[model samples]
Each structure stands twice: as structure tokens, then as C-alpha cells.
Target chain A: SQQGEEDPQALSIQEGENATMNCSYKTSINNLQWYRQNSGRGLVHLILIRSNEREKHSGRLRVTLDTSKKSSSLLITASRAADTASYFCATDETGGAQKLVFGQGTRLTINP
Target chain B: NAGVTQTPKFRVLKTGQSMTLLCAQDMNHEYMYWYRQDPGMGLRLIHYSVGEGTTAKGEVPDGYNVSRLKKQNFLLGLESAAPSQTSVYFCASRRPGTGRFYNEQFFGPGTRLTVL
Candidate 1:
């Protein structure tokens, strides 16, 4: 069974706009991670927010975690055409041997 | 240095044929994993290894086999290719720290496999 689910399966936005993606999970997690994947390519780790932390930021990326709601959101500011890719949220359970459970992902398209 | 690399960016196999996919990581990660991605489905883990010479089954491990004979290498094999196995395969590696939240998996360029 999938542990994480993302809302708005697809999104299209213009350049310089801000894009937000949401993910909701079932169980308590140690951390939530966001990754980006270009068409037919590998995934690049974007940001990681620990369970103890409510929010984190890295460059133009911001991640927020709400353990009470079992949800996380990723915000990319000033999006560009290069940002067109699929974004995924992965969760690691709260224990040893952190096995990742990934969400279905949100496909974002940035129109230049 | 190459982070994580998978060989044969694309492959085509016929029914009943067998093949193996190779994944190598230069980061000297202690953990490795194999996953398959079908359309609409996120990713399903096939097998994983915590260390060299050890392997464990993941969520969807019925038709796949894995080996981690070397510290920097992991292998995923298909005994008999089936059309249903056609999908994108990704290999990931990580050096998880002993902390509450340290799972960061680095993925390799996926292999697009097609079985007929």
C-alpha cells in the first residue's frame, strides 16, 4: 500500500510564479524528503525536513511538515522553465532501517 | 565522482529471456535498493541490501532477484522476462546516519526496459 499521497496530480504554471505541492501520509515518520525528476532521468534530492522540525528552506525551495496532520508541502518560488519536472515526496518511518515510501508525485510544468 | 550509475539506459527483452541490471555507487553507501516504476504507479521496491553480501525482499519482490556481492555494487536480475515487467527501473543508494530522520536516497539515471 502507498503510504504517501500527493494532491493535484498535475499543475501548470508560468515562469516566475510560485508552485506548491502537497503530500499526506498515514503513519508517523522520521523525515520527509522532496525530490525532482526530469523527463526520463534520475531523481535529485531537493529538500529534507525532519519530523521534529516544522519547516526548512534551501535556496528557492521551502518544505513544511505537520506531523499532526501527517502531511508535508513543498513550495518552489520563482519557478522557471527548467523547473518543469515531476516532484515526489518520500517518507521514512520512525525507526531503524529507514525504508522510504514514496508518493504518486505531482507533475509540474513551467511555461516560459 | 559519479554519484550513482546504472548501466544500459534502455533494454528490450523477449518473453522467457533473462537479464541483469547493474548499479554502482561511488559514494561508498552502505545501503542500496531496486525499484520499478510503472505508469501512474509511483515506485515499487523489489529488493534492498544494507551491506555487501546481504539482500532483502521489498514490497514487490515476487518476480525479481537481487545481489550485493560488492560494497559499491548491486545487481537486479529477471529470471524470465514478462511483458508485465516492462517499466522504468531505478537504483538508489544511501548512507543513513543513526538519527531520527536520515534517510536520503540518491537515485541513478533509470533504465527503461521493455519486454515483449
Candidate 2:
């Protein structure tokens, strides 16, 4: 069973736009992580928001967590062609041996 | 440092064939995992190892086996390939941390497998 589900299966936006992807999870998690995967490549961790924290920022990436709602969102500001990729949300259930359950992911395409 | 590396970037197998996928990490991480990705579905864990000589089944553990004989290496074996098993496989590693959310997995270039 998928613990996390990302909304907007796919999105296309113009360059310089801000892209936001949302993820909802079922169980309580220690943390929620966002990862990016380029075509035919591996996933790269982008940012993580802890259960206790409401939001975090890293460079152009912003992550927000609302544990009460069991949801998280990733905001990438000023999107560019290089930002085109599949974004996934992963959650690690508390006391679950650190195993991460990943979401289906939202494929984002930035048009030049 | 070649954080994580997987062998046989791509492979083709026939039904009932047997093969092994190798994953190695240089970060001296204590945890390693194997995941498979299908068309619309996201990556599903097949198996994982928390330490040397320790392996555990994950969400989608059927049709696969894993070994973590060395701290730096993990192996995934397919005793008999099936058509449905064709997918992209990924290996990830992370070091143990004091806090549960302190560690983030580092992934290797995936292996694309096709079972005809």
C-alpha cells in the first residue's frame, strides 16, 4: 500500500514560474522527504521537513509539513528547464525501522 | 567518491533465466536498499539490509532475494526472471544516525532490466 500520494500527476509550466507539488500521507511520519529524478537517472534528495517543523528552505526549494493534515508540499521557485523531472514525496513511519514509503510522484515539465 | 554504484546498468533476460544485480557504496553506510519502479507506480522496496549479513523483506519482496555480506556491498538476485519483473531497479544507502529523520538515502544510477 502506498503511504504517500502526490497530487497533480503531471504539470507543465513556463520558465520562471513557481511550481508546487503536494503530497498526502496516511500514517504519522518522522519526516517527509522530496526527491527529484531525471530521465533515466537516479533520484536525488531535495529537501526534508521534519514532523515537528512546519517549513524548511534550501536554496530555491521550500518544503512545508502539516502533520495534522498528514500532508506536505514542495515549492520550487523560478522553475527552469533544468527543473524538469519527476518529483516524489517519501515518508518514514515513526518506529518503522527507517524504511521509506514513496509516492507515485508528479512529473513536472518546464517549457522554455 | 562514487557515493553509490550499481553494476550492469542494463540487462536483458529470458523467462526463467537467473541473474544477479550488484550494488556497492563507498560511504561506509550501514543501511542499503533495493527498489523497483514500474510505469505508473512509484518505486517499491524489494528488500533492504540494515547491516552486514542482515536482510529484510520490504513492500514488494516477492520474486527477489537480497544479500548484504559486506558492509559496502549488497546483492539482489532473481532466481527465475518473469516478464512482469522487467523494470528499473535502484539501490540506495544511508548511514545510521542518532535521530530517525537525520539520514537521507543516496541513490545509484538505476539498472534497466527487461525480461522477454
Candidate 3:
């Protein structure tokens, strides 16, 4: 079963605009991670936010976590054409073997 | 160091055939995982290992088996291939964390498998 569900199954934005993707999960999580995958390639770990952390930033990426609502969001500041990719959210469920359950993902397209 | 690598980037097998996918990581990670990605399904865990000589089933373990004889290698096998098993398989490895949280996982390029 899928632990997380991403909103806006697909998003298209201009290159200079900011792109935000949201993910909501069902159960409590030890941490939440965001990954980016280019077409026909493996995923790359972008950022991770622990349950105790409300927000985190890495380069052009910012991740926010809200354990109370079981939701998280990823913000790509000043999106670039190179940033076009599929983004997925994964959750490490509490009490489990630390296995990650992923969301369906949001396909983001940055138009130049 | 090569973080993680998978063998046979692409493969095609007829129904009822068997094959094994190999995953090797040079980071000496303690945890290894296998996942399959399909359209609209994202990535689903197939099997995982905590250490050498240890293996455990994941969400979709049916028709699949795994082995971890060496700390740096994890193998996923298919006893009998089915069309439903056609998907892109990815292998990931991560070092164990000190506390409850786990470190980030490094993923391989992935293997594209097509079952007819």
C-alpha cells in the first residue's frame, strides 16, 4: 500500500517561478524524504526532514514537515528548466523495519 | 567509490522464465533494499536486508526472492516471471543510523525488465 499521496498529480510552471509540491501520508513517520527522478533514470535524494524538524533547506530546495497533519511540502525556489522532473515523497514509518513507502509522485514540468 | 551499481541494465524474459538481478554497493552500507517502479504506482519495496546473511520481504514480495550473502552485494531473483512483474527495479543502500532515524539511501541506475 502507498503511505503517501502527492497533490497536483502534475504541475507545469515557468522556469523562473517557484514550484511547490505537497505530500500527505497516513501514519506517523520517523522522517520524510523527497526525491527527484529524471525520465528513465533512478531517483536522487533531494532533502529529508525529520519529525522534530518543521523545515529544511538545501540549495534551491526547501522542505517542510507537519507531523500533526501528516503532510509535507517541497518548494523549489526559482525553478529552472533543468529542474523538470518527477518528485516523490517517501516516509519511514514508525515501528517498522525502517523501510520506506513512496508516494505516487508529482510530475513537474518547467517551461523555458 | 561507486555508490551503487546494478547489473544487466535491461532484460526481456518470456513468461515462466527465471533470472536474477544483482546489486552491488561500494559504500559498505549496512542496509540494502530492492524496489520496483511502475506507472502510477511509484516505487514499492520488494525485499530488504539489514546486514549480510539477512533478508526480509517487503510490500510486494510475491514471486520474488532475495539473498545477501555478502555485505556489499544483494541479489533479487524471480522464480517464475509474469507479465505483471514487468517494471523498473531499483536497488538502494544506506548506512545504519545511531538513533531512530535512518540516513539517506543511495540508489542505483535501475534495471528495466520486460516480461512477455
lDDT-sorted candidate list, best first: 3, 2, 1
Q: What TM-score should be assigned to candidate 2?
A: 0.98
Give lDDT tens digits, candidate 2, residues A1-112: 7889999999999999999999999998888899999999999999877889999999999999999999999999999999999999999888786589999999999999
Give the Å error, residue B77, model 1: 0.4
Error of 3 at B104 (Å): 0.7
**What is model 3's DockQ versus the real complex?**
0.70
Provide the clashing-pair count of each candidate structure. 0, 0, 0
TM-score of 3: 0.98
Candidate with maximal DockQ: 1
lDDT of 1 by residue, B1-116 (tens): 89999998999999999999999999999999998998778887889998999999888998899999999999999999999999999999999664564868999999999999
Error of 1 at A75 (Å): 0.7
**lDDT of predicted model 1:** 0.91
RMSD of each: 1.1, 0.9, 0.9
Per lDDT, the best of the predicted structures is 3
User: Which window of ten consecutive residues has the lowest lDDT sum in model 3 chain B?
Assistant: B96-105
For model 2 chain B, give the 10-residue run with minimal summed lDDT: B95-104
Q: Which lDDT value does model 2 have at B49?
A: 90
